[model samples]
Target: MGKLYVVGIGPGGLQHMTVRARQVIEESEVIVGYTKYIDFIAPLIENKEVFSTGMMKEEERCREALRLSKDKIVSIISTGDAGIYGMAGLVLELIENEQVEIVPGVTASSAAASILGAPIMHDSCNISLSDLMTPYELIKKRVEAAAQADFVITLYNPKSKGRPHYLKENIETIKKYRNGNTPVAVVKNALREGQEYEIFTLDSFDDSNVDMLSVVLIGNSQSFVKNGVFITPRGYKL
Candidate 1:
């Protein structure tokens, strides 16, 4: 049996992609992933065979990747960290004694956090507002709990064309526990083309500007902004 490698290519930039991830793609005969993700690494996989699927075809793509791994080394590509919300979990379920390697990459949260200065230097939790596989009510509960615990919250899949109000609802939920003036940041297409980032207060957040590609960071009570930087203090004596 040939080997299967699930690689995270990081957030749509060659510079941000981990070296090991690039190495695996170079070694593999076939690369499989969503169309946009595959295109992001097109420079590296020039001669390799690529099997790409459109959006919402994750399961199909994973199954095809597993099938291709039977005789030749195959790499399944994911944007950001594969283990976070990538193909690692789905591929793992189909692994049966196959030589498997999970190559991690920088996730969107870390990339966005860096761009936003240092808002996650303290305790934080990441949540996705996408209701594709998860129920909306369950997501709301999770947001409520995170807000109540006063954790720095990073929201992935904040908005989509069909679910524009999800982010608004999450903001409302978190506002219950935190002050309306708490700092919130929305980062779109982070570290990639058409990247945009903006900081606002919980009471002033604009939901219309967000989409599926955005990541929203909601700071805890201790977080603050200074000189155009959003920061969460790590409590060091300064």
Candidate 2:
């Protein structure tokens, strides 16, 4: 029987890959992931075999990995922390007597939050606004609930060409539960060179300016702007 490792390589590039993840990927005979995500790590595993899927079809990818584990050592890769809407959720279903291991990495939200300042320093709940599978109403409810609960909100899947108005929907949902002046930080590909971050007051967000590649953080009532960075304190006072 072969062992399976589900690894989170963090967001973008080889530099972000953890020491543990690199160790496992090097040992695995087969590395599997969604294609673009696979490309991001291709250079790291040139000597090993790779299997990737184009887009969607995540369940199919997981099943294939399950099959591969029956025959060879396999690493199923995900970007960012595996537990956060990443490959870990899918692979958890396929675990057998064969050992399945989850290796953690820095998720983009934490990376982005660090770049912008300390917005999630206190209490926060991360929510993805993509309604691809979940109902728009449910997504809306979660957004509203997150905002109302006064939790620092880190929203993923804010915008995409096919579903272009999620950012607007997110802004609308926050408006329902928070004041228009609630501070927000919009980060584009955080940690990558030339990364962009903007501090916006909730009342003035321009929907067309946001995209799916970005991560949006809406601060709680206590969230503040410090030296131009948006921050939600984790309640640890000095």
Candidate 1 residue spans exceeding 4 A from truth: none
lDDT of 1 by residue, 37-122 (tens): 98899999999999999998998998888888989999999999999989999998877767789999999999999899999999
Error of 1 at 179 (Å): 1.2
Cα lDDT, model 1, residue 168? 88
Worst 10 residues of 1 by lDDT: 91-100
Q: Which ranges of candidate 2 are over 4 A from the true structure?
A: 236-238
Best by TM-score: 1
Model 2 TM-score relative to the real fold = 0.93
> What is the C-alpha local distance difference test score of each model?
0.92, 0.83
